[model samples]
Target: MKRVFNKFLIQPKIVLSIFLLTSLIVLISALLEYNQSKKEINKLMENQSHTLLDAILISSNDAIKSYNLIKSEINQRLLNNAIFIKYLYENNLLTNSKLTQIAKENELFRINVFSKNGSRLFSSHPLSKFEQTFQNKSKEILKEIFNGEVDTLQIGIKESQLSNSYRYVVAVAAKDRSAIVINIDANKLVELRKESGFGPLLKKFTQNKNIIYLIFQNENGIIAASGNFKDLDDLNSSSFLQKSFNEEKFYSRIFETDSISVFESVNALIINNSKLGIIRLGLSTEPLDQIAQKIINRTIIQSIFLLVFGVITFSFLFIRQNYDSLSKKFRSIETYFKNIFDNVSDSIILFSNKLNIEAVNNSALELFNSKDKYELELNFNSFFVDLIKIDFTILEKEISINDQTKFLLISKTIFNDEAISNKFIFVIKDITHQKIIEKQNIRNQQLSALSDLSSSVAHEIRNPLNAIATITQQIGKDFTVNENENEFKQLTKIVYKEVKRINSIIESFLKFARPLPINTESFSLKEFFMQLKLQYQNIFNEKNILFNIQLNKDTQVKWDKFQIKQVFINLIENSIDAVNNNGTISVFAHEIDNKIEIKFSDTGKGIQEDILDKIFNIYFTTKNNGNGLGLSIVQKIINEHNGLINVTSKINNGTTFTLILPKVVEVKNV
Candidate 1:
């Protein structure tokens, strides 16, 4: 009882796993607490920093609004002046002096009127100021209004070419599609922008004790910076800063210098629809560092405790595992055998004493070409229905399925398993291919011996046949013909014919005795079959036979065309002889496993099972007129091509000959 209980107990690995998992949880809990506390502190700092950045951004927004407001007021003033000038021109009270007077009254820098064609009809400045140009200043400046693309255009704030000052230019369309242009000195507005920009914001944030520096900088240099700002890495040299600007994302990290460390936040700055540069705000990290030092001291103590506990616990598990190693090794060995049982190439089926299938390996399933155990069991029982009669010592047998025979080596043994009193194991190997090779070797030996024997026999027979033919010819020519002349001539003719027939037989024997050279070439079986059908159409028609060539797919094979043709011709001639009127002879071909399978089936008086095995033997014939060499030669040719021939027949049903030929003929003894 104790031994059985021990066998059923939990394994050492699982127990160790539980203990290790508990330890891991404790360690992870400690680390997570520390991380959560750190994250809380970081969260607080992030909230504060975010508030500060938002305030800076709000200030930038306010500045943008202020700058836009100032420009809007200037644009309105210039537009009103241009409208007044247009009113005068429409009233027919407009002249060069009128334009000049309007410019002076409005304190405008320049004013000009252009026709739809950009010809200057009026100008507030003297024409001498524009004389060096075409009929007007470059029309591109007011091209929108001149080309009637827009009624008004504010050509705002361009530096003056003649003076170092700037100009605020505007244009409006008047009567006849002429354009009225106006401008003013833009220096005062530019000064207003300078007073309300990012500079003040940068200076304002630098007042905080935490802020080490704050600046707005671009690729060239700093656009605006606080008075106490410190320079560190530049955009060209700092990929971190470049990433922040390029991705337009907010980023912050610790910035270390020889003197101090700071948490710096960076992001691109944009105001008034213009990307000015990046805003960099560096805050002192003294507070975060002081807290981090305290957390580190506590973490170090906790980590040391975990390391000591892990070492002690691991030592305990190590000793426990030593005691458990024997059982683990046994289990692993069992598993190894199980894997081998399933994966080995020989099919293995385990049966109970009652012959019920208890287990089958992967190879067993594959051997029977089944998907599951149920189907496999059924097939096994059906295929081996004579299993009880099988001699316990018989190691090899042949089984045919689908008119195809396979040689299997079956090994059966009985063993006493722990759970089952008697278990039968059948290990099977499909040795059909090996059997074919062995048979081929034997056939080659037989053919070689026969070739030699036939050579000797042919020499013996031909000498007598030649002498008899000469003597008979001399008798028919030299003997005197009396009243029995006709009878005498007929007898000589019979002698001559017998001699000729014997010679023909000897010639065929000699031909079979010699090696037939193969001329191999690639050809399409589909085309070859089609040609046969066409060439034999008249014969098939006369016999009223339905000759059908059914090809699964077009297959190209490299073979000796002449020899392969003889093989087919022999089969076809037999089919023609066997079939009666209105019978069907069909040729079928498909590719399988790189081999060409050709089937010749005929609806005819089928071969008897007893005689089927002897059909390919030399001089074996069922027909009276046949010399019986056709099928023997056919088998020889097929064997030479490294092919197999099988025949299936049922009396009065049909006979089908299946040929398994290699796509490429192989050189061999046969």
Candidate 2:
């Protein structure tokens, strides 16, 4: 029984099992907390959106009241003034600027005097020369004003500039059949409506994140305000706006979009016995996603931390509780914990709930500049404060510690319930390394796919090009000299030149996709270039371009001699293409720090900046008659040799290509 008890107490598996169980419990608690918070936030947003819509309706009511008072004054003036009656009898309405001035002083956008029959006689806005109709749409307001059913009424007409915008008016009919109309600026009304919706305060709260508040008006929705304008235009549709126009009260709904979860609410606006509009407030789910990720991360970290602590505690107890009890069992337990520490992908750290750094493993030490685990003997929270110096509460969510993203997946649990309530475990994982590896893998995949396509395309094009070259050569040779023969010869020569260029393009593509086999042999750089200089001597002389070769004595590298020669030939040819009549091309090779370095520079019209990055990308060329594969093939050859190649160029100045190949360490066959 004692033996079995000791096995249970000292085993690493039991300790790790406890850690796993604790992680599961903490994760469950975090999930519950997150769900509860989300529900509460959603409810609050719904209430707020409804309140905003209600306010818009109230504003609309106040506008109607002001319209009615103006109409009553117009009716009284028509009955009292004989001159006004005469003016109305001769013309449909009066166009006196003094009357229009009175309305303009009140901040109205437009004012028009119309006859009882609705013909516009006066307008405050500049009327278009071709326009024959007025913008006012509320004929009901005009009918009531003329018939004395209502003293006055507000009418809105859609403006021509905006598809659904309304030009608001307060119309009053005079006793002489003349009508006075006051136009309210739609923009000003919208601004007042948005301000009344409690948006300014809500916007202040969400300035740091994404939130959108909307109001529905006359079967159309308007985004009164938004904290984030990522998808602001979505509110322009009539269907989305009209849905909440009939709702009597407020309600909330959640919608999932391509990237965000939107929490939405609808609330009605009723003012002065008229339903004006509805309001909706939306909160994006990005924050909730971040919160969920935080919880999961914390659970994983805490579980791993607890497992490590348990292993250490069990091992120490086994050593102290009579060394002979289970010495072999303790060793195995220690090794098991060591394997977990070494093999885990993310770096691991254990911090007590008080936020003290208790222990760190090898991975953590290497990442955080600690020589050993014992060197990490500082309060975790205090260490974070000293390093980053940000507010702890804000740092708790997203924190960067010493160039490493120390994502804290944290969990809290009481050990005995009284003195250690602050006790918690934290797991720190380095996501930077993982991201770097992922990026490299993606780049490799892209290059490989492009290379495979280039190979097939090159093969398909080169065979047809060879046939064209043969046909051109045959046509040139078989033609006899005569008046028509001269024209035929020139045609064949042009065809031959084009075919050769095509063949050159195909060869470069093949080189990029399938590198020539390397027959590695030690060769002196001085002798190799000497042969190249002699071979290309006549071509350089004919072009009148200076060809300079600089070589360091006894410089050697292991590479296929022919392949390296081809690399130089392609580079030199490009330099010639870029050069003016007397431009200079210089080639230099040397032994530098256990590697062979080669540089080819040209004093030619330099490459443009926009095309620099694309120089090595397949099918990217600046030359009209050029195949864009030269630099791509150069990069492929350098990569095959386990070397680095880079180019720099400046427009109208020069271009230089640098190649560095590592020294080969030979493995001798026995």
Candidate 3:
């Protein structure tokens, strides 16, 4: 079995290929993981930027509202002062002292009274030696007040000629169709808004390195910006800019370039229901890219380790399972050879040089009538007269066992084995049955000639016996004797009686010369067994032998019942003669494979191997006072019924006779 496994070996190249394939898979997985992580980081950063930009837009709108509210307060205070000056002058109570006092107390830059012809009639302080003041710049603003179209006018904040001052102005109509104007100095308020407005906050947030650019831009130009984002598309020229401004909502998106990746958060600034501009804040993705690279490196390292471990584990398992498969195939081959060795018809013996039997099959045991194989020894040299060597030579010879002769064809061959230098396989075939069949053919020819001779003799003798009978009948009817009549009658009667007996003998010969035909019919074997039991029970009891009959009640055979009954009787009587007290005879019958089977077993002095072939030969009898016709007739009856019979015997072990017959018998002409 080990030798069988040597031819096939597992290949190592397949393992190498698989390992390489798995490594490729791990590498691809690492790359995919890197790309996915990078995308997630980009999304997270874009969302954060959007939140920041939205907060800044809200704060900027509030700042614009606060600046407007302060300017409104200054304008309202100036209108009140202008109306008070108009009231005093119209009632003829106007004077320089009152104008100077108004300027000092109301924090006014200056106050002037202008006549309808655009001439300043009164001033809070008289013109300086080298300075002159101008009237209100827009005539439309003053025309309504001077022409009595409106009683007052408001002028929002304006830059003063003085570098640090701003002004809030107002006017009212005077009684003589003149305008009274007033203005306040607003320099301190301008300083306060510059310090706390949204401009400083935008500049402060842009100082972070991650925030690449922040800008407030509209269709006209950039209103304000922190950080250097030089290239920008205006609201009208850029679709995205225009959309964001019109929506007045936050919008975020990512951009990738050769050097770096950036995401921008955009929003429109709306103050008092007015769209000022859209703010764009750009955030850099350098930090997220670094984190994604770390994830990729970690994944690659872990996958490499797993690839190596998997290759090692797979190699180990493949080697073990491959070896197991080889071993099983070897075992299967050994079993196949062993099966053939056991079932072969010839006696096969494995022996050594010294005629010691190392192993033997079932046929070999049966040939030697051995129950235990170990007890048997090879008798190769003793069986033949010649100095036969255990080589590849065939010999046909006659051997005797248990005092009966048998024909055997012997052959042998040598095999290679380390333990046994000269291991020979000896084959022995029993050819006794063939020899007997050859002899039975010759004997049958002789019997046919003898039957013909009997038929011819009976015909020749029958003619004379008939003539003599007729003559004696005539004498008895026509002739009479004179002296001693009783003696004459007695002598004639004796002659007639002797002739009649001769005719009877001739008729018996004719009957034997022509064979009798069998009358076949269907019969239940169970009922047959019952009748056989009743008939043979006493005879078996006389010898104290055990008899067992087993059969199915429905078993039926189409055969000549009378002829089969005689066959059973012959077998039973033979068993009785062979066995001693406490011996056993068992019969088992059934139907199998569409045929009837009957097994007759006996624990009697079993028949010798050599004489088994001659048991059915005509005139061959082993028992005293036996005519040797019983078994011969049985064989003939079975042949006529188109059946078969087989026999196996072992010395002191018992004999089993197996009879098989067809279910349907073909009848012959009577």
Candidate 4:
């Protein structure tokens, strides 16, 4: 019993489990605290918004009263001026200059006089442009004035003119139905309303800066605005303000910009039994945000303090009880496995039957060219596919990764232990380079045997072919033929032509059997391609094909100039034959990773896929007259230069041949 108890006490997993449980409790507590604080702050802000709306309503009411008082005073002043102007025009003391002097003295916008029949007789300014319209509009105000309602002439504000300035028209009636009309500038009245009413009230109420903006607007548009006038102008046509205005009630909403949160309140301003306008106030909620941040900060501090205290207490107790034994055992086990994992050459990946990677050693990471174990696990299926079966024995397969075709000898086995069960253990071995070398060796042996056989046959055939050609030519030159014997002479000519063709075939075979020795030298690729372009210019022109060469820079490569030139010439000739009129061929050369890569792309009839692999075989020809030795020789020369050649083609689309050659070469004396 004591031993069992001691084992349980010393187990590190128990301590870890307790720590995790404690951390979970702390996280839950923090979340609850944060949510509760947010709810409380939101409730408080809602109440504050109500109070702020009430304050804005009271302030805006006072401002509207002030506006009404200023409007009444302005109206009275305009009526008195109109009555005085009517008295002067009735007495006939209002000459043109006197009317203009009176207009200037009173600082009126304009003044006009009408005859007893409501026709304009005279004016301080030009009346021809507006006299008819003014008389037509003043008929109503003239009726009111002539009715003598309350014995005081009154002025009424009109809508803005084309100049966007307000106009006020006042009419005063005389005994003969004659009246004087005056137009007063209402822009000054607007200035007075702003200075005495909304402007001062807004300034006084929003002194705290929390009320960031205040605006007063009537049916005539924005009359007074303060604090971010541009923002107020933007809200002039807001749906929220329109709804509040239509409903004639106070409405509140929250608006947020990139930097600040604003609680906006809209209320109708009613004074003297009429709605003056709606008042809008934008109150910043930055203080409430500050309160929320403080709550979160306080909760975090308390949580961290508790967590640290608990950790310190548990660590002290654990160290006093079991530190030495656990440390020694852990170090021993870690070192034991680390040395084995690091020293092994083969990559070893341990995964589950579900193909999820459990662990990877150093070799496995390096083999996959990865930095993390999780990355390998996530992309495990990409590296190996269709790996479903796992038994006690190992299975091997090849896979490709990152566009590189590699030979991987994979083995799978089951791992059954206490911590894990039915897990897969994969051991991968790369054998791509070895496979290539083996195939190259086999091909080299075959080529060597074929070369020897072809050499012997070509040598034997060349002598007989030369002798036959000489005899046929000599017979043709020595004998004379008549009209009946013309057929005989034609047959001799055919014999000589056949002999020459056979000799040419034998010469090709001999050259294939033993190629010319490579004389290596360094030459500029730019100049070399330039010369080649010049050589092929006429051929391209005859075929109506375009040829282009793109070079990144001047590059020098040590190669046999004659052999490489022959390779390019053969490729170009094939390209020319493959294309018809208006085709294009392009050559590109650049240096990458200390190697020169050259690509020849042609817009021509491309080779089919099925026969592309066999194109380099001896005696294989796609064309009736082709000898099938050109590409084979090109391949041989490139191989001798220690380069790689590959082709990609699509039928009817085009073909591209890529050659990668070493920039520097070292030739050994043979």
- The model with the greatest lDDT is 1
User: Candidate 1: which stretches are off by over 4 Å?
Assistant: 1-117, 120-230, 235-324, 382-391, 481-483, 524-556, 572-606, 623-626, 648-662, 666-670
Q: What clash count does candidate 3 reach?
A: 0
TM-score of each: 0.61, 0.28, 0.40, 0.43
CA lDDT scores, all candidates in order: 0.80, 0.61, 0.76, 0.75
Q: Over 4 Å off in model 3, which ranges? A: 1-347, 358-409, 414-420, 429-457, 468-502, 513-518, 536-554, 569-635, 644-660, 668-670
lDDT of 3 by residue, 1-670 (tens): 5554543344467666766887887788777877777777777776778788877877787777777787777777787788789889888788888899989987787788888877778888886431143554435558887677888787656676646568667788887789887877767677768855656867888999998878887788887788767655677897777777887767777675445567788888888878777888988877776787788778878887878787778768666866788689899998998999989999988866676667789998888776755555533435422423534478777776664457888887777788757667778899976765555555455555655786899999999888988888778767899998888877778888999998986775575457647788998888887898789888778878888988875787788899789878888888887777789999998888878889888898899989987787655798888866677767666666767666667789787777778877778747
TM-score of 3: 0.40
Write candidate 1's Cα lDDT for 14-88 as tens digits.
666866786778678777877887888877787777677767877888888888988999899999988988898
Error of 3 at 416 (Å): 6.4
Best model number under TM-score: 1
lDDT digits (tens) for residues 197-239 of candidate 4 = 6678777766777878778787677777677645343334677
Which regions of candidate 2 deviate over 4 angstroms? 1-447, 455-512, 665-670
